[model samples]
Every structure is written in C-alpha cells, then in structure tokens.
Target chain A: MAQNPNRPISPHLQIYRWGPHMAVSIFHRATGFVMATAGMLTLLWWLASIAGGPESYATFQSYVVSGGEEATGMQVAINWFFRLLALGVTYSFFQHMFSGIRHLLMDLGAGYELKTVRTWSIAVYIAALTATALVAMLVAARFMGA
Target chain B: MGNGTKLGRVRGLGSAKHGGKHWLDQRLTAVGNLLLTTWLVLSLLWLPNFDYETVAAWLAQPSVAVPMILMLANIFWHVRLGLQVLIEDYVHDEGNKFATLTLLNFYVIGGAAFGIFMVAKHAFTGAPA
Candidate 1:
C-alpha cells in the first residue's frame, strides 16, 4: 500500500466510454455543488430581508422577484439573470434529490447489477426532469395569476 | 529510522483512520438532506404565493421554522463535506488546498449560523405586519 510512483493511473474519463450511470454520478456531484451555492446565497438574502422587516422585505422582493413596474434596462437584465438562475437551481434541487436517493439505495447493498444500476440512473434523470417541469409550470402560473 | 514494523508503518503512514468517519457523515447528511429538501419543495409548492410577505408568514409558523433551521444546518454540513472531497481531489498544491478547505469551513459555518439566526428571529418575533 506504500506509494508506487511507477504504477499506472486508473482508467477514468480519458479511458472509458461514459454511460448513463457515469453521467448520473457526475451530475449528482455537479448539481449538488450548484444547489449548495445558490441555496446559500438566496437563503442569506432572504433571511436578511426578513429580519429587517416589511420595508426591507419589500425592497428585496422588488429586486429578487418583481423587479418593479418602473424597472430600468439594467434592472431588467439583472432580473432576467435571477429568473434563469432560479430555474437552474430548481432543476438542480430535484436532480440532486433523485441522485441522492439512488446513492442511498446503493449504499443499502442494492442496485449493484449493471442493468439495475443503469435503470436507476435513468430513473433519476426522468424523475428530476418531470418534477422540474411541473414546478416550472406552477411558478409560471403563479406569476401569470392563473 | 525505517526499522519500524510493517504494521506500524501501515498504520502510521498509510490509512488515515478518519476517512470512514467522513464517508459515514456524508451519507448521513445526504439522507437528512433528501428528506428535508423534499419537504421544502412540497411546502413551497403548496404556498399561496412566493412574495416576501407570504414566505415570511410561512416561516413564522413554528412548524415551518423548526424544519427550515434543521434543513439549513444539514445542507451546509453536507456542502462542506462534499466540497472538501472535491478540493482535496482537484487541488494539487498543498498550500492552496489547506487555504481552500479552511475558507470553505468558515463560509459554510457562518452561512448556516446566519440562516438559523434569521429563522429563529422570525419564529420568535412573529411575522411582520
């Protein structure tokens, strides 16, 4: 187990053809990181606004949610950026959740077979996509006052 | 002086007995996050609105506030553990890796504390009128 500098490095992205399970595994880590950053920032801003009371909350809403009726062009651009970020975060949340479930099941000594692993991997993706779409639609409906 | 027994060398220099703890903690937080995040999504979806007032009102409820605090703590802990592994793997320079890990711990701890404090404030003081 001592260091062996002459030993060849293990096969990885360069040597292997990626498959569903590999993709899902990569995405699980990637999305987890993304959601963590986004969640931290949003939560901090939200908490600050709430602690500061209604006036501060209103100010935060104008910036983060509504963008106000008399929005400047720059403000509009920023609002669009936040909107896209919000959607991305929503997708990440679901993707990470499903992938986490897959990992939990694997940890429980299940889904070791190739077919079962692949099936679960694909299932995670599908669940994330479907849930993200539904949540996006609900958000849109809420915004449109439907 | 290279005279140590093989077992001594292996135990002293080889396996860092702490890895299993890190792995175990990561999985424990992962399970916590799975449940809490699901609850969060469902709660948000059930909300009447996403405006500041509506969200503030929701957080003011003791039921919501308690879980929200727990979720925030679990999330930050998990984030730190995951990011630590990522940094250790990719960051080659020992100095940089140490710096990055230290900064990461401070960031996650500080952010979690701020979040929980806010939740507690709202929970205790009630929603703004």
Candidate 2:
C-alpha cells in the first residue's frame, strides 16, 4: 500500500471543543494505561513478596505500610510519598472501573444520546469518588482500631 | 480492467474481517473485570487486618484463591487487549508496533502466570511461616 503523506487528519484536541464525554473518554484511556503499568507492577510485587517468605514480605510491608520506627526525616518523607502514590492508585482503580462500566454500557447499545452521555460521564466520576471515599474510610477505621 | 466500482473496492479493502472478534473480546473482558474487581475491593475491605500474615491467610482460602486466580487472568487479558489497541493507534512504525505488541504479550502472560502461581502456592501449602 502506498502511503499518503498529504492525507487529511481527523480533528483532535486542538481542533475539537472540550466536553465532559471527551474528558471521560480520555481519562478512560489514561487510567487504563496507568493501571496496566503501575498498578499491575504493584500487584506483582505484593504477590511476589508474599511468596518470598516473611523476611521479604516484611521488607515490602515496611515500604508499603510503614516507614520503620527508627527512620530519619527523609525516610519519613519518602514513606509519605509512597503512601500518596498508593492512594492515587486506589483512586485510579475506582475511576477506571466506573469508566469501563460506562463504556460497556455504550457498547451494549445504550447511552448514545448526547444528554445521556453527558449525564453518565458525570455520574461515573461521582460514583468513583464515592467508592474511593468509602474505601479510604474503611481502611482508616480498620487501621485506627475503630 | 476490473468490473468492480471504486466504492466496492474501498469497501472490500476496509473490511479486515477480524476486527469484530477483537472488539468483542475487549468488551467481554471488561465485563469480567468489572465483576471481579468489585469482589476484590469488597473482600479487601472486609478483611480484619491488612498485615502480611492476615492478608496471606485470607488469600489462602480455596474460596478466595479461586476467584483471585480468575481475576488475575481477566485483568491481564483486559490489560493486553487495551494496550494492543493503544499500540495500534499511536505507534506509527510497523516494526515498532509489532515489537511493542509482542513484548506486551510477554509481559501480560508472564505477570499473570507469576500471579497465579503465587496464589496457587498459598492455596495449596498455606501461607509461608
């Protein structure tokens, strides 16, 4: 096949007006990519740590859940950084999942109308936020002995 | 000269015949992921403790291990399908696209295999002491 160097390109970000659906669609892809990469890696590390016996598992746990009681200021800062990353991944998990459900519904011949699309896009965000908050609260309660 | 019209030629060339299967598999795995991930999140939240021993014991149950293995498979399959679309869309060079996709397949398969093995070990032998 001959390449068409002068072929017209489809309208993209610069040419198109931004909207809720567009943002949601882009977020779907972005979150999918991040989860597939970083999320999967974290999962693998966790599983491997479990399989590696207590010493290795403890090392992983220290990095993931605690900063080590004797750690210096810099180590504490780094521990908080990892905690933030874990939180972000957790949020992304919920967001990506809700968006995935939205896409599946659209594939099943629903949510095509413009109003419905807009409504569902916002709804997905709201649902993800709610789920993330619930998860965070539950985790906090568990950790705090409540 | 051929008898077919230009429009017919265009239509014939555009139908790759395999696109539908790819699209269908992606959606199917998405559905699976939706269900499986929900179970995962809820189960994790329900666990009394988050320490390594507790979590490992939780995963060691037959009930937990089986579903977890299923979830791992579904997750990796979905990741592969999604990443394949991404590679096809953005990677312009034919060789680069092929190489990237091949590597992606390896990554997903290897990761899934390792995950399943770990889960199965725990299920069979109980969690390491």
Candidate 3:
C-alpha cells in the first residue's frame, strides 16, 4: 500500500454546511446527552433525599414549598421554572426514546433501503414533535388549571 | 470457503465471541427503559408533594419498587452500551481501551446498583408512618 501525501479524507457532518434535518439530528443527540446528565442529577437528588434524613428530605421539597424559609417567593418562582424545565426534559426524553428505538431497529438490519430509512426517519420526527407538543400541553394545563 | 481468508490460521477462533448477544441485550434493555420511563413520568406527574413519607411509601410498594429496580438496571446497562461504543470509536490504544472500558462498565453497574439499594433500603425501613 503506497502512502499518498494527499490522501482524500471522507466528508464528515461538518464538511458540508448543515441542513435542517442534520441540525435536528444533532440537537436530538445533544438533548439525549442532556437527558443523561439530568438522570445523574436525579440520582443525586434521590441519594440526598434518602440519606440526609428528614431534614434533607425537607430541603429537597424546599424548592417547591412556597413562602417558607427554605424557599422564598423567588425560590418558588425558580421551582416553577424547574417545573417547566421538567416538562421540556420529559418531552425530550420520550422523543429521544422513540427515535432511538427506530435507530435500534435499523441497527438490527431493518430499514436499510433508502426509501424505507427516509420514511421511518420522517415518521420518527413527526412522532417526536407530536408527542412533545401533547406532553407540554398536558403538563402546562396542570399549572393553568385547565 | 475462500483460501485467502484470515480465519484459516487463527488457532483460537472459536464460538466464544458474543458480540451479537451483547447487541441484543442492549436492545432489549433499551426497550425496557422506554416502557419504564413512560410509567416513571406518569408517577412523577401524580406526585402531590415531595415529602419523605410520600416518596417512601411510593417506593416501598412492590408495584413501584420493582419497576424502579428494573429501570435502574436497564439505564445503567444502556449507559454502559453507549459508553462502550464511544470508547471503541475514540480510544485507539488497545490495552488502555480495554482497561478503561472494563472499568467504566463495572463502575456504572456497581454505582447504579449501590444507589438503588441505598434508596430502597431507606424507603423500606427508615420512613415513619
């Protein structure tokens, strides 16, 4: 194998300017990573709540406990912010899950044809959007009393 | 059947390889996690407050506790799978890659299980009525 000084490198995602679907896919992976980070954070919350006794438990709830020493009005507002954050994270988690299952299926030798792959990708995208919107509406309704 | 195939002289090439098995395990766990996460979201929605007794009671019941255990196990397994793929792609040094992957797999599983066990023990035994 003769070594060429000017060997052609394969084009990666960055080689070409990003398009809509490519950007969406990148965000999809990013959100999945974010969800994983959130999972670890939740594990921390669980451990602290379970380990630090009732005082720690109270501290965990302090975020949502309005007009209290542990939670001031501003803190309550922050907690509500987290509630909205939770809703977004929830939607991302599910949408990622749904799309991941499709990828898993493709990895298993299914959906290899270009037509089939594109069709499923579109389906997954649509499902993700619909699911995210539906979940956000449901969660927002809880706060709005609708 | 090809003469130039590398398998002819490979003395230790046996049925010990389990790549497909690992792939299947990862896929199955991924599916389990998806199902459990749905339930988890609904449970979180139903949670009225974050009091100790409430969380403890919810966790102590077998209905919820069992799913929680399964979810923990599967999530760690999926994490291991994702990390393994990442390490395989990025880590070029063979010996170091093997060591790091092995350590990472063990750490993820061990830490996750330990965290779950600690929480379960607290929920089952420590909370007051």
Candidate 4:
C-alpha cells in the first residue's frame, strides 16, 4: 500500500541517534506497555487465587516469592525473576514519572528554552535513576527484613 | 503599564482555566492509586495461606469487593486519559487520533465492565468449596 502523502513526515527512530526527548517518549510507551501487561498479570494472579486450592495457591505464591529459593521451579530462581521484573517495572515507573513532570512543566508553558529543555532532560534521567535505586533498596530491605 | 499591559494585568487570574482541573484530576487519581495499592499490598501479604474458599469469602464482602471494583475502574480510566494524551501528541493524523481515542475509550470502558462482571459473578455465586 502506498504511504499516505497527507501524513506529516517525521524522522523514525532508526534514522537518528537516540536523544533525551526520544528516550523520554520511548520510555513512556515502554513503561506504559510494561505496566499494562503487569496489570493483566496481577489480575490473573487474583483470578488464580480465587480459583485454586491450597496446593495451587502455594504454587502461585512460590512463583511470586521464588527470590530466595534454591531451585525456584524450572531452573530459574524466583528471586531473580522478580528482581528483573521489578527493575524493569521500577525503571519504567520512574522514567514515566520524570517524563510526566517534564510534560506537566510544558503544559504550564515553562521550560520552553533550549537550555531549559536540555537541563530538564538531564534532570529526568538523573531523577529516574535515583528513584529506581530508592525503589530497589526499599524492595530489598522489605524482603530481607522478612 | 500600557493599555496592552493593563489588559494583560487584568488577565492575571489564578490559573489559565481548565488546566488546574486536569491537574487536579491527575493528582486525585494518583492518590487513589496510592491508597488502593496500599490495600492491595496488605491484602497480598495476608493472602499466602488462604485457600480458594477463604479467599472467595474475603472477596465476597462489600469491604473487599467494592474497593476493588472502584480501584479497577479508576485505574483503567486513568490509563485511558494518559494514553489519550500520548496518542494525541504522537499520532499526527487527525483521523488516526480520533480513532485511537475512540478505541481507547471503548477499551477502558469494556475492561471495566468485564472486570466488574467477573467480580460480581465471583462475589455472588457462592461456589461450593
């Protein structure tokens, strides 16, 4: 099918080096998709809990808390699985939050200058990482204390 | 303070109008997420030992059932609003933007309905253990 000429042309991802705005935008979608899937996973877990008996429930819980288990069922440690999932989710959450704040600033019509945009973009990255670390540490502390 | 300055001076209301409303809604929904998530976390913590029957009984109560239903609806609605803005920004085609928003609205509403239907069925069915 012929591409519609009426569409405004914009550079695709492959055409240019990735930059902060691109990162922010892509990460927003990435996190959005991740959380959406996570939401579904959560709902499934709830449904399974409602449907299953003790043994099945234990199996499900095992899937959730497999972090410290030896075998962790099927060669992968549940802890590791959770860690990776948490990292992605946490990263996405923070990145989205950072980008969101940036968007909010834009809505207020602040940070319009090039210098301001660049500074905010850097701040977004820094804040996202910091938030990610904070989340990870909290999760670690909670699980460790338990 | 020229006349242009005077008109500009008179226009200095508290907010730009409508912007604060959107901002307030976003914040309220976020606060809802925080509270609902706390409940979910606490419930999940308590849920490890629960059997199917026990869990069902817990969910059957209005306390658990209603909050959950509300949370589910609000979460999806908030997501719809967020994605609506994203699509509006990125999807340049006017027709495409409209279609996406319409599709997103249906998705959110349909998901809420389906979720409520399932929760109600489980809540009222009184399935035998």
The top-ranked prediction according to lDDT is 1
State candidate 3's TM-score.
0.72
Tell me, by DockQ, which candidate is best: 2
Clashing pairs in 4: A66-A79, A67-A79
lDDT of 2 by residue, A54-136 (tens): 77778777776676778778777776776787777888888898898888888889979999999999998999889888877
Clashing pairs in 1: none
Q: DockQ score of candidate 4?
A: 0.14
Whole-structure CA lDDT of model 1: 0.84
Show pairs that collide, candidate 2: none
Which stretches in model 4 have alpha-carbon errors above 4 Å? A1-8, A43-56, A67-79, B1-68, B81-129
lDDT agreement of model 3 with the native: 0.69
lDDT of each: 0.84, 0.84, 0.69, 0.68
State iRMS for model 4.
4.9
Q: What is the TM-score of chain B alone in each candidate?
A: 0.87, 0.87, 0.78, 0.77
Write candidate 1's Cα lDDT for B56-110 as tens digits: 8888988899999999999999999999988987775778888999999998999
Q: How high is the lDDT of residue B124 in model 1?
A: 86
Tens digits of per-residue lDDT for model 4 on B29-93? Answer: 75676577558656755654444566777777778878878878777866776776678668867
Instruction: Score every model by TM-score.
Output: 0.88, 0.90, 0.72, 0.60
Q: Least accurate stretch of 10 residues (summed lDDT) in model 3 chain A? A: A1-10
Q: What lDDT score is found at residue B71 in candidate 1?
A: 94
At residue B43, what lDDT does model 3 achieve? Answer: 92
The TM-score that candidate 2 achieves is 0.90
Query: At residue A22, what lDDT does model 4 achieve?
Result: 64
